[model samples]
Target chain A: MMLKSKVSIVKGLSYQGGLPMLSWVLHRISGIGIILFVGMHVAASFFVHVVGTDSNIPDLLNVFYESWGFQLFIYFCAIFHALNGLRIIVLDLWPQALQYQREMTWLEWLIFIPIYGMGVFFILRNAFAGG
Target chain B: MSARSTLRPRSVQPAWSFEYIMWFFTRVSGLTMYLLALSGVVGAFILGARTQVDLQTLLRWMFFPNRFHVEPYLDDAAFWVTAWWQIMQILIVFFAVSHGFNGLRVVIEDYVGRSFWRPLLRSVVFLLWLAMLVIAVFVILQA
Candidate 1:
């Protein structure tokens, strides 16, 4: 059973979910992903680089780090998290921009695709070059 | 904590006074993170470019010498010589960590409801966040 209410304080807001809401959710997820990566990266670097922890663990992690596939996933998360963050900042700073949020989201995607594409291309080239 | 600042009505009032402030910070930090992350990601690739090794070769080299001999490459004097790079790295790391932890807090609050263990869980999460932040700072500076 579901209760109907005008106001609900779920996911930090009392509003109906929509495009902007979706953006917020994605932003949260991406931000958390980056944070998790930071933790993993730091721990791995510490043991391998500083303490010289002898184990195959760092090697296994390095495999993922050096993979083009993983790089692309990270790049995607980073690019969206950043540009969507910019959109959020604009909306917050200029209240009027709220009306144009849908447009802003579209514009964000427009900008993101090309940059992400170029990044992917660069990573791929580097991977295949065997340099 | 019970005196109302904005007058709409008690029934429709916010649950917590700090909610508004936290909401504002979430957005502000979002903006900061956007700038920091953009530069950091691009800067990382650019710095890597300087080394001129591709993915496969780099891996083989790293593992061949000593299996997974990964070390903090950022500690390279080349990176430290540039102050702006270090600053960017620090800011990016801090803002990203803060924003993410705060966000996770919000998620737990929303979903955990009025559970007896909420405070304990939240505290554990916060402590872990603090520890991670400290370790991250140490690792970055050591680099």
Candidate 2:
């Protein structure tokens, strides 16, 4: 059996925990996803730039970037990561605010939606505009 | 879930110094990532439009010198090489990678218990990070 740490974090696969916990998990998952993307991007650029090879690098990147699904996924990840990053900074700056972390999480979601919506709007507009 | 139990007490702290260092690093890196990402997004927006400055111009400056040897290319490349934005983007890549990987480390530590597999998993993660760092540095620096 796993030794339980004193922290009251929710465990188990159900992950039915509240928003803070959910935020924790999503933040981690999104962060990891972004890392994978970054790694791929760096590696691809390495070949195109460092090795000075064409090798369809531009084509691959354009295809990936132009795909709606990939774009939306990256959009979501970017929004969540950015907002969550601010929330973290706030909490860290005022540790007392940690008590209101749940409220902060809710506020983060509230802030994330419209900003994200605007971003998606532009992204979709650009996509459809064929520019 | 009262406030009292929420925090680890001063008495039973495990590896307090190490945790403090990691916590400090996270905050510092998180702030840096936020700034870099913001600038990067701004750079992207500037690139998307047909402005005086664009992403390809920055790329040609940062990465591609041999492929595009036109006058404008060299001129744009020269202007951008010293530009703060180009440097910010490069640093962003490095910080974003480190922040993401470190975030993964936190996740693994949180979810995976102190089992024999934990160390093994960490080693694998570390190796992956090392490989990424080497490639990332090469790509970022070797124009």
Candidate 3:
């Protein structure tokens, strides 16, 4: 574990800039995002017991997807969270990639762009179609 | 520690109070988010189960508030149930954003002297959270 502890990321890269920092921060962030999302899912499940088959269910669902504001937020969150998670996993496995870190970092953005587009498409589809 | 990490008052003069407060807040928030996520998954299962069963036979006179005559969507049960879950899942988004923000903050600060470089990312995180929170509040109120 000591070797793991000594595993520093700065060794791979020669320069300091915002891009690498963003990825590093995002890697941690996406992890935390997933954790929190899972937690809220559990808590909200409890409400189902009380309001099981409640009439408000449809309206609530409609309200959520009916609006553009929530939809856009969700799309962005999903895209960034997922893309950043992948970046972290890759970095952890290949420390030497720091040498070509910029290329890899841009790759993350490349993947994210499409994912964001997909999210927007679905969110808009659901939002406009229903309400 | 770089000026970026050191820029925070805590790095300059560490104290039990600030650390303890931050620790407590994070754990409490983390646990809440964890449980919330769990419940949602379970809720999905529960709703799924209802779909397979004969809700018409079982739910008759059950006194559920949302009960009605029309088939809400995929049968009377599924549409209602899935929608209900979706409404609640918004909170999960909030928790997720918070958790992600906290983790990002640490990672950005981990670099030896990169505090100066982190402000922009931190600002982005804060703004996203604020916007998400505002939307969540509005949606929940509308619900």
Query: How big is the positional error of residue A96 in model 1, measured in Å on the Cα after superposition?
Result: 1.4
TM-score of 2: 0.72
* lDDT (Cα, 0-100) at B1 in candidate 1: 18
- Candidate 3 DockQ score? 0.10
Model 3 ranges off by over 4 Å:
A1-16, A25-40, A50-67, B1-143
Q: Which stretches of candidate 1 lie over 4 Å from their true place?
A: A1-18, A127-131, B1-16, B34-79, B82-88
lDDT of every predicted structure (CA atoms): 0.65, 0.66, 0.52
Q: Could you give the CAPRI-style class of model 3? A: incorrect
Q: In candidate 2, which residue pairs clash?
A: none
Worst 10 residues of 3 chain A by lDDT: A38-47
Tens digits of per-residue lDDT, candidate 3, A14-82, equal 446578787755555546544344334322332343345454554555455436875565445555755
What DockQ do you compute for every candidate structure? Answer: 0.28, 0.48, 0.10
In candidate 2, stretches whose alpha carbon ends up further than 4 angstroms from where it belongs are A1-16, A52-62, B1-16, B37-77, B83-90
TM-score of chain B of 1: 0.60
TM-score of each: 0.69, 0.72, 0.40
